[model samples]
Target: MPCWFTLTCAVLSIFAFVCVLGSEVNVQRKNLLGLGSLQSVAVSGRLICLGRPAADVKVKLYESEVLLDSKLDEGRTDSNGVFRLSGSKREFTTIDPKLNVYHKCNYNGLCDKKFSIRILVDYVSSGSEAEKTFDIGTLNLANEYSGQTTDCIN
Candidate 1:
């Protein structure tokens, strides 16, 4: 009976130690700066296709002009034409950093339509993260047509 009591006490002490260790690990993760430190941000937008709500359209996100996080990382939109990208946010600002997205149609030589999406990048200052929405403003996305030029005889 004495041996059993000692073993039980030992087990309890181990469990307590594990709990304390877990709490410390969580604290460390939260302290990490940059994108990892961010919790989440709301990305809502309207699907624009032919100057209208292009329902079921895919949205994407980029970091430093390169693709980092995408709309697929979050989820798809609904019949209401609303989509969101939620995940660990990062500092994004005119002075903080820059992110760009390439509209698929704009890359092809056949399409001449301009497509653009809004990206919201959060900036962490001191201990708080501030949210900023980049409209990408107005863009005249052009299609690169690589072909021979035609000449007519007079």
Candidate 2:
């Protein structure tokens, strides 16, 4: 049908494939011991600039405007333009948090739309509590256009 629909279907197919083959992928981290209740979670992603990989960009994770974790030392991306951050994985019963990605607009002064994204974090358990790793993915960002201005002042 349409290009967007075709693209979406392709992406969904890829995701399905990954899910089916997920068990084949090996994890680098070892299982933790001496388990305890859930604590926090981890958030990670890559930053891009001008459709090119950007490095040394800070990604902040927050909980209702309150600073939870900051990746100052983890800063920057690699040649592949990928960055990652890890936090304590909490239980799903607990209230989840939202994370915000901030960056300068590469469009120069062409548009005022801020180049940023918001990701919702939820609990996805693996093995035991002690030997657990939070999984974060499916992050997609949308760009806002300043050209649209229709508001009733009244």
Candidate 3:
């Protein structure tokens, strides 16, 4: 074989290998973005009042002062006063997260007002590709509401 033909064949082989490798890498990246590297947040805690668990209370999670979608980002305390809220999104972004607890532990049904508590959670995400779980520990509802007073408190 001529020297030029041999060199051409070798170069073609390298080019083909590089193309195949590049395509494979692209496919793997797509798969990761589609299913593997999704960002999720899990928030869990317990509601307590007067040394007892407060059951059936509504728990809400907010990001940047906006309420998260209720269908997937809110929960109610169980019989043990434990609640868990989870949310997932495609892109990883830093969030200012807050927890709100609503219950009628203060007054009877006649008051038509419920006690509310707001907790500012320090969850500064590094914007990495990993699931995050925050255990906010137990929230005591026995104390006075420290959050802003709204018209709901009539």
Off by over 4 Å in 1: 1-36, 62-72, 89-154
Better of 1 and 3 by TM-score: 3
What is the lDDT, from 0 to 100, of the residue 40 in candidate 1?
36
Ranking by lDDT: 3, 2, 1
What TM-score do all the candidates reach, one by one? 0.34, 0.41, 0.53
Off by over 4 Å in 3: 1-39, 65-72, 90-93, 109-130, 148-154
* Local accuracy by lDDT, each model: 0.41, 0.43, 0.61
- Model 3: per-residue Cα lDDT over 1-154, one tens digit each: 9999999999999999999999967865775677343444567888887879989887766554233322326778998899988664433334445556666665455433243333333443333422556777887776666652323432
Whole-structure CA lDDT of model 3: 0.61
Best by TM-score: 3
Q: Clash number for every model?
A: 1, 9, 0
* Candidate 2: tens digits of C-alpha lDDT, residues 43-148: 5665556566655444544333224433212344466556655444423243243444444435333323222233444442343231333334432223343333
Mark the 10 consecutive residues where model 1 has the least summed lDDT. Answer: 145-154
Q: Regarding TM-score, does 1 or 2 come out ahead?
A: 2
Best model per lDDT: 3
